[model samples]
Target: MRLGSREVGYPHLLAAALLVAMLVGVGVGAGTSSSTYGAFNAAWDGGSGIRGVASDAGAETQVVYNTTEYETVDPAGTVAFVISPERGYTDAEAARIESFVRAGGTVVVADDFRPHGNDLLARLGASARIDRTPLRDDRHQYRAGALPVATRVAADPLTRNVTRLTLNHPATVTANESTVLVRSSNFSYLDRDDDGELDDAETLQSYPVVTAERLGAGDVVVVSDPSVFINAMLDRPDNRAFAAALAADRQTVVLDFSHAEERPPLQVALRALRGSAGLQLLFGGLVVGAVALVARRGRLS
Candidate 1:
């Protein structure tokens, strides 16, 4: 390559490409994740759409990679979402979340067939509990009974315009009837035996899929299925509307990924640098030094 009277080598072009790639990675927190419902995942089953929902509602979206950061969040103006955690929280970790809720922060726990979400709910002293069995509706569903369509939505602020919710492999929540926000139809039955057929012994009944309870000055909202918040499922207008309402009035909406199995590497590194003034200064010095050296070499040429 020729630049004015000077010639550029192939090595220089390769270096430029590498630098561009690195900047792109740093800009977007590039990394691959095998875990579902990860905040950074752009995949179909991921929860990345929730970030967009928060942004569209005029709220700041924050992805918290550590539960230790929970104490730093201002409970007065933050709404936290804990979705499909890969691992259970310790006593201390659960207590931190509980404190955040009790101090006037809202928390939404969306999970199914996992003990982790229920464990957190118990620690929060909330009466809501996600059942182990998968709820199926043969009458009211999108395609199959496994994917039930919940039309029994409560007329709450969060579900104001939401008419129906399409669920994927959801569970039922066992909570006080008054606290229920969404429920399965009367024809729906719990697949306790994992069999598609409803046996004569198992009677069809209405079960709660979403519930909420007041905790001190805050609120705890439980959704039996976490998949409802995923990217693919958000295509449903009602689902997207409900998610938008959750973040609508909040100043800051947080996606808690502390118990997640994986995270974007660049995000973690940037967050670490942001927390440390020394590291930021050192990184800045290196950048300035590299630019000065390059300028000196150009002048000599």
Candidate 2:
């Protein structure tokens, strides 16, 4: 009365195929909608090992940029902000931003001491130092592990919701009369090698991790740790609340996609599609095996 493996597997395989088809249909629908903002949206959806605070802020929140290829702007009431990881700025772009801010635009600059982020720092009237030394802190270490803390901030609108902040593998910023938003305790110092490994004996001086300075007619906020804004890290109450507080009052927010560089959309899409395909194949194989077994049993009976 026993059925061979192949004979039992067919029906099970057919069921699996049907299930996979249903799932794929749902996935495709979700992926093609305006709601899907691609990789940046994925990063905000808690994918980039950092959590995003603005995900729940509103439905209209979007990422903006000034790259030669794409410039996205929303006419509705929403926040539009630029994100740049570059160290230098082109003369034309600088003038455009300066003019925008002079007209009461708000720009949040996030960088990690990379050369790409330098020009933005200079424009903000601050200098950045790539810490070659490791920072150690006994007081400010996260549950995951210890991280280098930077300068503390004075009271300001940008940091109003942020009482304490953490920066993982961060660079340091120094400026005269700069309002320190969050700082590493005296126990913490910069880890310059940036190997994510810190040593007490090799500690450098404690410095600012996030700071804000007043520029001509607008304001500039600088962050040394980009990890705070990533999807995984942004979920932390402190980080999320801080981001919400930073953008709470702003009417328009721009997320600069210029720093994203160039990558093929089809390649990304194919990768996503592959996951669905694998599931379909697995389901089909299981169904076929089950059907074959059932058929063999019927024949024996």
Candidate 3:
């Protein structure tokens, strides 16, 4: 084709097509995400803030897409964050996590309004259980009653420099065996009926929002609300401090997304490509061909 007295060769046209296709692929991969709590998601409710927090604390951060990776990771210097899993964990997967914790790995289970969290706790033989009921505070709240503030922070490594924690639609943690690190104010009450009020059945009292318990040589820290580590809530000073504390002294921080509802398509595709030698070779050949086409067109020009 002739454009303003210049001829566009077939090689040039083919190279341009390849480049445009590559650019479109890259754009689509970056713009699409179905995950809610995905570490790669930069949206408000995503856990991307916690990933930055871990990286800022000088910890090597990674995301675990499969529970099989749990067996390969070194437990001694690692901390795993299992937050708001929408899917239930398998018996073997739960056992794998339990073994990871028992073998001296720190596992932080931050969940609310999910039966899967309690199920995993039971599987791990943890004494702490997450109450599914939503805890609301009328007095010590952030912007609304649903978003309560926990002023009672205990002296612990996880609660260091954290005077108050802001929670979002959180549940109360009940633990007879674990050490309570943070608690809601006495004005907080469990919204059993979801009426958003202090009803006749509900009474205002302090409830545990964060707890830590020792299992073997490792530790299991449970946060009643996973949203505390999300991008929206991490803006709160105490929440950010609390997230930093989770990665403190840990060499590796892992965001466990094995049980999550959605996984990033780009990450999934990359993992699949990495595992297949044929795919890699194919992509390499295509890249080489595209370069060769451009070089040939330049020579012809």
Candidate 4:
């Protein structure tokens, strides 16, 4: 018996629906996996954004956190990551992060300060004291012709692949018994208040901006300022190289998605699920749906 047009089209519609369901199922399953989730965040002042972008570029699995909503986001593993302090971390949250690090999980805290003074610095076995004096240098200069600018590394894995880095009126950082991956030049000194004036009498010598420490079975990396990896600055060659290196061998990278103003778990999941078969299926379903709709309407006129 010859089937009517509506009846003939019903199979295509059913096929399309089934394809969509299958795709969604695959996507949901893939999204739930550890390899398919990326979390990150940007601070209100744009410091965290730089750092977050650098980290995201190099991470296999990353989460960005810049808002309070992410505080409740369940970390896939033992690590609780915070990229920038633009959103600020409470004492309790810091304690939790510390616990996560101690439990053989990595915590990367990037901010400006001395090696041991800053609260996060202390947690990472470093201190952070702002150098309220201007830095003097003939080698590097800011856009405003300021001297002794803070800089990132080109040879280190954490920063070697980072092509660009942002530095908000940053202060040089210092660390003890930790690996200093990046440093300011000798001519550079801290200008803590950022008044565009340097005082040799009040200057603190070249300090560490980024450092790494080993804690128990895990490690903590601290950056003096969060601006070294924002999206705006990431286009720079040095920052991009540094970011790539940092993300190179890591199996799971977290971005502290809780820190961003917008938290989209699905977006994180899709990015993380880049190479998954489920993603392939999802795309395939989308193509199939489009074709089916087109075919259905083609014969309508």
* Model 2 stretches astray by more than 4 angstroms: 1-52, 55-59, 67-88, 123-134, 144-153, 193-205, 262-301
Compute the lDDT for candidate 4: 0.52
Tens digits of lDDT, candidate 3, 105-173: 999999998888888888898999998899999999998999999999999988878999999999989
Per-candidate TM-scores read 0.92, 0.62, 0.88, 0.55
Clashing pairs in 3: none
Ranking by TM-score: 1, 3, 2, 4
**CA lDDT, every model vs. true structure:** 0.87, 0.54, 0.89, 0.52
Better of 1 and 4 by TM-score: 1
Instruction: Give the per-residue lDDT of model 2 (tens digit) for 20-123.
Output: 99988866554432211223345343222211344444433443334331123322323334443533567666666655555455566665646565575565
Native-to-model Cα distance after best TM-score fit, residue 271 in candidate 3, in Å: 2.3
lDDT of 1 by residue, 130-170 (tens): 88798999999988999998888889987878888889989
Q: What TM value does model 2 have?
A: 0.62
lDDT of 2 at 67: 34
